[model samples]
Target: MAVTLRPEIAALPPYRQGRAADAAAFKLSSNENPRPTHPAILAAIAESHLNRYPEGAATALRTRLAERAGVSIDEVHVGAGSSSILYQLVQAAAGPGDEVVYAWRSFEAYPLMVTVAGATSVQVPNLPGGHHDLDAMAAAITDRTRVVVVCTPNNPTSTSVTAAQFSAFMAKVPATVLVILDEAYYEFDVDPQRVDGLTEIANYPNLVVLRTFSKAFGLAGLRVGWVVGASYILDAARSAAIPLAVTEPAQRSALTALDIETELLAGVDELIERRARVFAGLTAAGWTVPEPHGNFVWFAAGDQTSAVAEVLEEDGIIGRVFAGEGIRISIGEEGSVDPLLGSAARVVQTLPKAGENARLG
Candidate 1:
């Protein structure tokens, strides 16, 4: 007989990663920095001593991040990636009979993470234009709610939560409920009014802000990320984390990336400019995409998502497709712009515009 397993765990599907692209296609399915890795990071990785275990706590990296954020070393926690810290925090804060609240269509991993922790997910629907409806999310909280995640420039939609909106939402949350501000795309966001989690973290005892080297630093292969918050809360998350998960090479490369942050951020600025062009191109193509504040744009193709995605692939563009929902195209290499726009325009001309497949109003 098969070994007994938790019914909930058995029913859950494995996490889906962005599809790989062929030699001829541009892989915009994953929102990755399209820049080549800096020489400094490569040199740092070469210096790692593979024979020894990584500093279990990632002390040097945490110390540097603490100084940068103006927090104590104890307040900074390192993980394999921001997603790892997210799972750790959820496991630390919630369990069976508890609930984790977040906006629907924000991050694709939210429901999966919560369910894996044996917690129920309370997902509030997004606003008309793909932005988080903070008011509705705050109202969804209850006594059983142990954690709330706010993903600005939310994944798959690329819409952000404004500073004013977040402050108002926080006012309604009980001090006991933990709030995780996931800022994986912070460097690409140009909105002056967007919620700056590090700036606001000091104001809330229950808040934890997650940042990653994977995106802006072009360290997706290295997989280093961190969280800044109260020492006690982070301690709990640290306890839940897998030991030695943050490798020596990952930590060293992250430190080198920070050493040359200005140079790395210049690349981010270029992607931001490219994102603007993609948005304008999609609009001109008769697709009403939401105003993207991240390194990606959302095409609300609704039921026509698969067909539109196929058209994109035909034109050498590969993007994250949420079947029956929408398509998320990441800002990619400079040469990808023309093919992306051409594909989008052709889809608009060829497909039947109905339901959410038409212009968002």
Candidate 2:
């Protein structure tokens, strides 16, 4: 006899992560905020109990998040990270034999998470401009569809579908299907129009908005994220969540971080500027990069993405290479980006002065 795991689980692709370690690594594979956590948050977490059980209800953190999010405390649900709660959302909201639709190349996690819940995934292909094709996504939905994920400023692509488009899609889509808007990199932008979809959730009962402290708050290691929804939907997630999934220190840190939102957003301003600088820098360097509203940049360099990444990795600056599809590089702290920029300059300088035939890898 032999032991075997679920075929779908065994067949699932591994979750891709940003490289965050190395002596000289400015490893920006993960879309992490380069800024360190707020000192107040650090102090609060340190002062909190190490052995006590975290509030299973996550009441205080929920209250703070609700105040900041302009929603009721009951409308908020905290998790170890938005990613974790999203996993729970899929399981609780969707089921086997159901289909989950999302944009291909959106968040790499959507498909895997959907499959883990025993649902099939339908990833609508990206539009020509690298944005999610909401029209196609909405049309792809069928009665069997249970949830649809919309990752704005979509993960590897670093592009977003506009609010108008999202509104149109939301209008036509059946209210029975849950629409999860995963805004993992929400705080690092100045584009009011594109990211303003947060408030739009109020109108749709099926809306589930996901956010995290991992980006602007620099709390990736702490893993604090939450869901904003109608009290009914959030209550469902609350009841379904693994008991006390959030740690006390992480919740305390998230609360302290919320109190200093202004300072944190100010740092976000600098990060946005640096992202623009890097975008301009790449464009001036004669590359075909996309306009990104997130904290990172991606370009369609064909096979050269791997080449650029290899040269960067050799220089001890690890970047994410999508192989033939393209490459994504993140904007971190000033000191962090300096080394990355240096390596990038060399990778660009040494490559063939022409097409994607040049292999820097």
Best by TM-score: 1
Lowest lDDT 10-residue stretch of candidate 2: 352-361
Q: Taking the tens digit of each residue's C-alpha lDDT, what string does model 1 give over 1-361?
A: 9999999989998888899999999999999899998999999999999999999989999999999999999999999999999999999999999999999888888999999999999999998878888899999999999999999889989998889989999999999999999999998888899999999998999999999999999999989999999999999999999999999999999999999999999999999998899899888888888889888999888888888888889999999988888988999999999999998889888886732364972
Per-residue lDDT of model 2, residues 195-241, tens digit only? 45468877888998999988888888989898898888777777768
Quick one: best lDDT, which candidate?
A: 1
My TM-score estimates for the predictions, one after another, are 0.98, 0.93
After superposition, the stretches of candidate 1 with alpha carbons farther than 4 Å from their true spots are 354-358
lDDT of 2 at 183: 88
The superposed Cα distance between candidate 1 and the true structure at residue 307, in angstroms, equals: 0.7
lDDT of each candidate versus the true structure: 0.92, 0.79
The predictions' CA RMSDs to the true structure, in order, are 1.1, 2.6
TM-score computed on alpha carbons, candidate 2: 0.93
Relative to the true structure, candidate 1 reaches a TM of 0.98
List runs of model 2 lying over 4 Å from the truth.
336-339, 345-361
Q: For model 1, what is the C-alpha lDDT against the true structure?
A: 0.92
